[model samples]
Target chain A: MSSTTLDPSRRGAHAGTGGAPAGGMSGTSTGPGPSFFRVLNSEFIKFRTLLSTLILLGCTVLVVVGFGALSAWGTGQFAEAAATDPQAAAAFAAQGGDLAVGVPTSGIAFAQLILGSLGVLLMSSEFTTGMARSTFAAVPKRIPAYAAKLLVVMVTAFVLTAASVYLAGLMALPILDNYNLNLDLASPQSVKMLLVNSLYVAAVAAIGMALGSLIRNSAGGIMSLVGLFFVAPIAFQLIPGDFFVEARKYLPGNTVEPMTAVQHVPDTLEAWQAAMVLGAWVVIPVVLAAVLLKKRDV
Target chain B: MIEARGLTKVYGDKTAVAGVNFTVEAGRVTGFLGPNGAGKSTTMRMIMGLDRPTSGTVTVNGSPFARHAAPLRDVGALLDAKAVHTSRSAYNHLLAMAATHSIPKKRVHDVIEMTGLADVAKKKVGGFSLGMGQRLGIAAALLGDPQTVILDEPVNGLDPEGVVWVRNLVKYLASEGRTVFLSSHLMSEMAVTADHLIVIGRGRIIADAPIQDIITGKGQIRTRVRTDQPDRLMHLLAGDGVSVELQENELLEVTGLDPRRIARAALDSHVMIYELTPLQASLEEAYMELTKDEVEYHSLITTGAAAPVQSGGN
Candidate 1:
């Protein structure tokens, strides 16, 4: 265990800087540095190595699939009651005659909460545990690491949510079949619901990561995330002004409903408007967090 | 090589590191010595680009650290032992840090073994002792075989053997023409391990010179004398530019005079002196004198009533 094994062969060429080499130590590294792809790889490694992060991902799958099964049974019971009553049948028909399409996504609300908090923890833990010093030291520009982590968080959120939703749909197939209801998982409406919901979850995760970077505390970041996605929606609903109602429609949580709706809901914004609003929700905080991260000392 | 110009860091109303300039040259082990809160860590962080300097600039290899193409390769630093996520395995933490520079997995394994972490590489970092954490930090710093190494308090929690290993390791690194800058409060360790020393006190550079020069520069010559007539020797040896203090009944500490002069005076005065010893200043004493006024926090040594009382009534 001698330091001789630690030495790498030095090259005389200096790679990055143009300044005159210091005397007697003219050698500089010629090996690979922190490119964008390398930083992305590093961030992905960090993302996958945490047991707590894996536990959160596992919890999301269980909650989503488990709720999908429960929703299937409940929707079956509702259809049975509609068969016995004309008024109930009319109400069911008003639901676009497709109660089963929404069954697979019934647990999306909880999925957002779990995965969003995961996003927040990913960034905030870097500060809480003092890993930010190592992280920023490796990529001193700072923005590349932030961008890389954001990409990892959002992509993982989308892929995991999409897979969980699909698995939940698979888990619900027999239950829906028992009620003689048809749910074509490959249908246009179903596909749109899956893709849109996954994208929406990814957007929520980006917002959570941004909040994490800005707050730099796991508890505070997660609380702010919950306040934005959960409490604000409810609080806005309970208030009685048109401004509150209009603002509620623009809340990130509410934007998903409008974008994923089969048709325009009465009180919701247009699908494009919801998409833009969601983009703003992610971009504003993310840009601000990047700016602050660059400016502040680790 | 690392250089700083007008480097300053101010936190609220307190300044951690005042504006100072110095260069850590290559091919030598430069020791940064400072008391607590004297800003050794702050200066290192600024050099590592972890902390933004309030005023000026610090550069490694002729440019700022953030400007380096491969910073890990150009300048590896162990700023703190806790600069790692506790939940991750030691191997995985190094792997992730290495992945940033596209360093190979073999290099990671090599550092792990080199730092004596082969046995606990799979364990979570949270479970590591302070010494183990330090080893991991050193392992990470060597992950890229960096040219300039900056370590703050590298020998802090190490055992005696580990301390010796660090001493040899820094000297070895410097011998390879690599710049090694380490900070420690142990002046004795600095006296032996470093070739050049930088002493900072009260957020300012108080002494920056060769280690030998710092040890011998400010200390005055002194002699200890023991005699039968201590008062007679004290009065007889008293002269211009000489100060004598009676230490005990027959022992005296005479400063600013050589031991021969004290002996000649004692012989001439028939003082019956049995002990005449010349005392050279140790690095510890020199450091105490250098930082005596610059120490930010002083521990009061109460000599009168703070002593435990003897129970005589029993």
Candidate 2:
């Protein structure tokens, strides 16, 4: 069974279904068949082929573009009043008065919500609909499937968010120019905002994926994501204690403020501390979900 | 070939699949026949590495299923018809699964054609009938051209024509020396399709043998003797363990006696026998005989002794 059997063609051959040729790796070959590269390609294909996923991607773009245009108009109205009122002068100075850089991704919150839900649906649906059986059947290591899906989710989240932000910037240019305010998509500050917001959304999507894998319920996963980003921060504030204030800095949702701020805000976590907090948010749940997935019955 | 050694799955307090070993050899259709909750699906899932077994180990060819580098090429399983995102088109679903193995586009279309899903390939699976959904699932299973094929209740929603198509397909696959492990409670279908069977009840295998042995090995053979004098035939054949039941005033069902003995007795008694047909034990009876006592959880509402009737008559 060692020499003549090692032809690779006949090694793992069971009953031949006998129409198409054997796929890339036949049964005869041994040792870690579906490499990470192959798994990544598989995950990419799974990511793009669904209509629901595409619809969510499309909605992210539309929301970003629409909100940028609206925010441009809002900033223009505020700029006109800054010259007339002393109180408005103070507010305009606080925003740097050239607010067009911020208009492009004013809808990052909604973008996070939609793309995060996309991440949740991608994984949770696999289990809810029984595709996990087929998925795990193909990549039984379980971790490969989990990691591949996470890569797919995070990459899509980054790309879609960045593209939406860019399109929003382009759309906001004319709206901002009508008020004689300068908007530059090429400026260092503008690019930093795009990169930071896109990464923030990517992190949020990863969190959503972890919740989905752990919860395995669509509504439940999305709800948990919402609780983390939207509800937790406000609830922490209303509770009114120094512990809550300190704990709020560690919340995954609070990382974006420190990242996007030009100068670190007073009484807030520094940029490096926030990055570590975000890293922990992604690493812990993802590892836990992967372990549980391998342990549970499909 | 699929081999299991002490493959077991225990969920919290309840034991679903007890420690049991079985081998699914290549070159034949091995039917995993079991009652509703008898752990057939559980075993298949474990084989696919979808479930972590509590103790035992199962291997496809030589290594554990998940350990395979290209598992799709090793095994293709249709665990359920609805194992798909119903929002996606049947074609796209196959395309995504195919992409995972780097299987080409042509094979995706080929399986769609082979499974007779050409018309509905572009349609969303959510709107599909159960039969169509089963066809899609079958297409997905065949996407990798895997060596070993595992199907759970492959014929559940198929029409008679579709069922026949699947039967022929499996037989052809086996003819090519491939391993086929399928589970179905439809004894009649198994009777025609499977070469060997492993009958499981309550997570225990009651009998594992060739189909013929299952029918003939466990019970007495009955011969139907249609005579003009039913009463005469019954009385004539009655002796010792022999018992005859009269039906339709002319037909006598004789058990514990072979056809030759019945004919000899009729000749001696001068009773004219019209139709002397021998009835072999059906798989239904054979299965009943196999599981009559082993049912871990029997239903409270007692239905006919469907198992014993056919087993005893045979």
State each model's CA lDDT, in order. Answer: 0.86, 0.81
The lowest-lDDT stretch of 10 consecutive residues in candidate 1 chain A is: A10-19
lDDT of 2 at A36: 73
Docking tier of model 1: it is: acceptable
DockQ of prediction 2: 0.27
lDDT of 2 by residue, A12-38 (tens): 343344333233224643323567777
Predicted candidate 1 versus true structure: per-residue lDDT over A226-273, tens digit per residue: 999889999999999999988998899998888888889887899999
What TM-score is obtained by chain A of candidate 2? 0.88
List residue ranges in candidate 2 displaced over 4 A.
A1-33, A96-98, B218-314
Candidate 1 residue runs with Cα over 4 Å from true position: A1-21, A24-27, B218-314
| Candidate 1, B250-277: lDDT as tens digits | 8899887778778888778777989888
Query: What lDDT does candidate 2 reach at residue A60?
Result: 94
Candidate 1 structure, TM-score to reference: 0.85
